[model samples]
Target: MRTRTARHAAVVAALLLTLGAPDVAAAPAPPPPDAAGTADAESAGAALVARRAALAAASRGGGASGLDFGACPAVEDLPSRVRCATLRVPLDYARPDGPQIFLTVSRAAATGARGAARQGALVQNPGGPGASGMHFPLVADLPGWERIAAAYDLVGYAPRGVGRSAPLSCRDPAARATGPVQEPVRPSPAYKMQRLAQARAYARGCARRAGAALPYYTTPNNARDLHVLRAALGEEKLTFLGASYGTYLGAVYATLYPRHVRRMVLDSAVDPDPRRVWYRNNLDQARGFEGRWRDFRAWVARHHSVYGLGTTPEAVQAGYERVRDAVARTPAGGTVGTGELRSAYLQAAYYDDVWPDRAAALAAFLRGDPSVLAAQAAPDPAAAAGAENATAVYTAVLCNDAPWPADWGTWDRDNTELARTAPFETWANAFLNLPCASWAVRAGRSPVAVGAQPERLPRTLVVAAERDGATPYAGAQELQRRLGAGASLVTETGAGSHGVVGGRNGCVDRHVERYLLTGGRPGGAGPPGAADYRALRAPRRWFVAPRLVAVHGEDVGSEESALGVS
Candidate 1:
């Protein structure tokens, strides 16, 4: 997922409202219909209450796991690695004794030298509903990560619907269609109609492809699975560090199993509200992009001579519109069409580290050279496989977790209004989520009311970016508000990326490292609004800002002008 250019517009989109809703009241679950539904709810409820009781009992007596690392498995293909037995859990908590699902578990032996077994096992997930965590011990090559990994017998698991665990694959023709893109959204009826149809089709396609499994793939269910994994690992209490969506998972775990937690770190946190899910979150994300866009515009204005688009920001914007209109009508090689533009634009928005390269690529393309832009824009086939799997699971779980408006008209009305204010990813994101329209399975419980104030919880660390478009900093504010004395929020003043874990802002990075290593969370309350926020150190300089500006919005930086053709 690495790229050289800023694709400033792309980053603006990716960084868009990354934070979750602050008021995380769980959606109301349907009232228990029959005795079976009632009984099942009670059982699930009992299991949760029992788990909490066990955690309390364990704390009083000793810890959760009584067994120590007795005998190690013989080393094989990957020496220093050992596979533990899978933890069997219900595919449907409603039928706890019915079809069973196995949770895959893997770990590296604690490095015996240097008194490295500092704490117990450190369980980690590398984000992505699709990213494989089974090999995290060997793959996480971060500078100081090894010390912790060596000492903690780093552990990882494949969540129910991904990797080595049972997976959901989508083979529908509708699912295979590339989603449409709409930016600087217009008032055309055609654009609106196409967007509505696409969303419904995508939801239906997933429901058909991923059957019964869809209902059980929710964040709360995943939290329950974590407890079962804890039992198998024989760890009395679980220690965790999650990034991006992983942060949302971690937050759910804390809320559901408050006592079983030994310690937790949520970086680039996701909001916990079910209603907001991915839909409303994208709206807040649009604003985040606007902020980064303004930052980029100022930077581009300063370096106008180098880019040569224009001297003032307004002129630079005119330049971008010219390229966008020209490319829409006549793309380079014809093959590199709007779809590729959309994908390339999305790729560029993922990081602040490469904005300059993206600007250069656009400038080159306008001047009749597309080699650099093509090289960066083309999709990686191997990564695409993982993207497909992750996206399918993401859709299935999201669609089943709650009912999106079945009425396309309602969606049309909502989106039309959204386009007026936040046109950046509104329509494009709506198309991406088209699958929910016809999801095969019925909806599950929406989130119930979550605590408005912090209660019994352990000290936790939260990392948030001021201008993150994906998970906005606002959710972090809510999380900080609820966490009270038990948590600390570290604001990355100048950066805009998802999750502050290891993306390389030293201030945020050091704060996260310290918390993970010594349970040290920096104390600070960030500014109230996104615009009022500041960067931790000097804001990191970016070259890719211009291209990112394209996807996020025209608000970031004015677009580059096309050079006159000979």
Candidate 2:
């Protein structure tokens, strides 16, 4: 996922065009890396040395025995049942004895009467390409989560370069302190040049600090690491739950190790098209989010008595624009600028549950109170290092997983054209991924071809919201089609939240629970709509105020925050 500052700007002219044009030609593959000289051989040698050092560090407490489980450090509100451990896997699978990296794994033991006969570990990932899953097991307390835990151990792990694992850091503290903080809106020729320079500098910093490890940070590698974790946990087959980018990772894992999968659930599935990898997905997201924002406007209009913004969607939108213009001219609370205002409201596109908070913030801003807006605009600086690490990992994985166009001309031409229709996030999304144009590492492999071969894979359940702005509903449909009969798609009709399961949607949760427990697939399947299932309604409070804070930290322009492309 791209950051908010880097992923939410727009091109005004493009906003006037039609939405949903047919697919464009796929991006051309990048040229192969230098492979004909001593330079190549020397580069290979250096990489091997670094890998060895990483392996040595990972081997500190255990040698080849896998993870060493123990009590986790006291995390204030983390569940008491959660246990933490670290597992070492080769940084490069081909070199088993080469460098190794540790993955921080957390587990919630099954608590049902059939605990001893538990199905196996259900590994979970919350996406972000960078989001940490260390606390995911704590969700066992949620309605459906406990049932899932009853059937199997809930396992969550921070992928190789995230959280308590051997994290990847690219930004020098000093550089980050002084670098450009926000992307320019409707970038001018000069702004584009400046962005290009920043992109190059960011790429160079990553290479300088983590180049040796960057190649190994691809999704394919992460999948391989998953298999290693599976083995370490003594599981014969992997049962998994992944959301957003996690869905993409799950797809890759299933494709590579089909028979190893037992039961899998992918929420907010990503389109597995190599061409769309990161860039095209963001374009799709721009259109999707615009639709979602319109939905928010309509919702706000319906409650005009409470908000007093407007009694019509257009009027509400105009009110928002007035505020946006004000911020552009003079920031709110001397901190929330035009960009921050956009970022603050962008969450409304992700989940409607936060609408009230967003509504309250907007009303407060209009009432001359910018505190909430300022808080959303400027995140706690103490969290900057962690946020940078997540961004670094996000960039490394995306840029290295598949070949991104190296030619600036391709990006310029494509984004310029896309801006014509999907204006809201076009420029920002382009800048979010701009670093790939000057990425220092060559892609480790071609994009994984994810398709279901039912004969080799087990039944899988795919969940998506009908109006998910980030991953978009179309990607879920495409993923279901690609996975063929091996997959069953469940859609939350009329809903726009990015992550659907475990959000107190009894209708969606029931299908998920049945699939994970009894392996009983939903019958008469076309695309099971959330409205079809009749069960208890989710608590009113759920939709009123879901946790606004993202699982990892400030998501900014990231897919986790806005696009769900991670």
Candidate 3:
């Protein structure tokens, strides 16, 4: 579900929109002020407490009853390590005592310098809404995670319906295209019919396979589950580091259970407004991709001799358009279609480290190299299996949590408007989500509207970048305005990328680490404007190299600053 914005260091910041539940029907009531100080924090913490009791009750006796692990698991005759266990919760929170599912949990105890242990467990989530956090303590060395690892028994677990946890699987392989081959033909009966068919098939297939568990996969349930995990871990308060969707999860948890929170960090946040979750978030991602595209175009323009893309940004863009047009007319090898090309592009848009490789791949494909495009189209069995499970869970949770407009007319209008600007991904994205229109379950409670009001709660630190496209910088600003005194937003200037930590901005990481260790939030709360931020230029962009996709263009790259992570 992650969306690539700009090529920042490989920081975890992708904004992914997963499909699962139906629309929310009832909006939760806003909490009283003097509850939690600051609007954003107050709203978040309030929402959290409201669901704690219900979620806690659901955690007992569904499928994972009476399961517990005290210490790290020792797979071999090896040193003592983190422990692993399971906790059962209802598949549907509405029926807390009904059919239950097991959620996987893992913990790594602290081992500090001189053998001194850190205080509480610092739980971390990698933000796939699909990624596994079970190995967080093991894999936390990625870029900028070491600071927190030193002082806490790092903890993480897969959200229900995800990895290691009992998963939901999509049976249809046809649904797993790298991208959509079907394009919208304006005023065409065939296109409309095809859209309806694809939408219905995806929805029905998911409902048939996912069943009742769909209703229970919302973020609220996950927040509630964390409390059970907190209790099971013997910690009175929880500390957290959640990036991307994990940040949303963290925000929900804080909103629901203020007292249970010791310290928290929400990086690359989401729409605090529940109703706009799908709409605005997707728009943000589109803009991010466009911005990155422009950046790439400019970079390519500078190397005209090498790329043969003309010595201007406009020319580079024209060259890319030609490639896209070719892809649309004739799918590479008549099999590696335009859909595959778009998917490759989308993946490249995710990080700074892979920009060069993706650029190279696209270049090759444009240059008539069928194998390059074919390779992009090829699917790996393991990845496909994981994708099937991930997609099923994502769909089940999204469609079941809240209802989507079943009306094709509304979608048609919305997509038409969206495509006017975001032509690159608009239709393809619409097709990708066509299933939501026909999902089986009806909608649930509508998301609550949290107003800005201060109350009693621990001070929290929020991190975001100025140029961030996926989770726009404005979200952080609004969140800060809402939180007021109790929260602070540390704007990571110019740094771009999602889901990556500690790679691009030392200042940002130091700020986060200071807060985690000492409970201090960002200082010098500046006015919400462009002037308040600074830039942290990334050293690279991550993704597969772009193949030579254009027939008449020369190879690009060969620049000192061309797509390498520092």
- Candidate with top lDDT is 2
Candidate 1 lDDT: 0.56
Candidate 2, position 510, lDDT: 79
Candidates in descending lDDT order = 2, 3, 1
lDDT of 3 by residue, 107-196 (tens): 666657455457678877667566666655553444455556667777778788786687766576545665436343242657767777
Clashes of 1: 65
Residue-level lDDT of model 1, residues 92-208, one tens digit each, is 654554566766666766665566546777787656555546554543334445556555767766788885477766654234434322243364677667666665655665667
Compared to the true structure, candidate 2 yields what TM-score? 0.80
Candidates in order have lDDT scores of 0.56, 0.68, 0.58
- Give the TM-scores of the predictions, in the order they appear: 0.76, 0.80, 0.77
What local lDDT score does residue 92 receive in model 2, on the 0 to 100 scale?
A: 71
Stretch of 10 with least lDDT, candidate 1: 549-558
> lDDT score, residue 310, model 1?
69
Task: Give the Å shift of residue 228 in candidate 1.
Answer: 1.7
Put down candidate 2 lDDT per residue, 1-566, tens digits, no spaces: 75432221111111100001111111111111211112566665555444333333333333325566678866412445677888877777546667767788888878775444577788888888887777666666544566777878888888988976788987864455432134455778888888889899889988889867777788877876776677667665678888899999888877756656777888888888767787678778888888888888888888888988889988987877777777777777776676666776778888786787777777777888778767666645676777898888999888887677789889889888877766666777778788988888763546766773333345677887778888898898778767655566776666777787775356677777887886755644243222123223344452332222111011122112221223
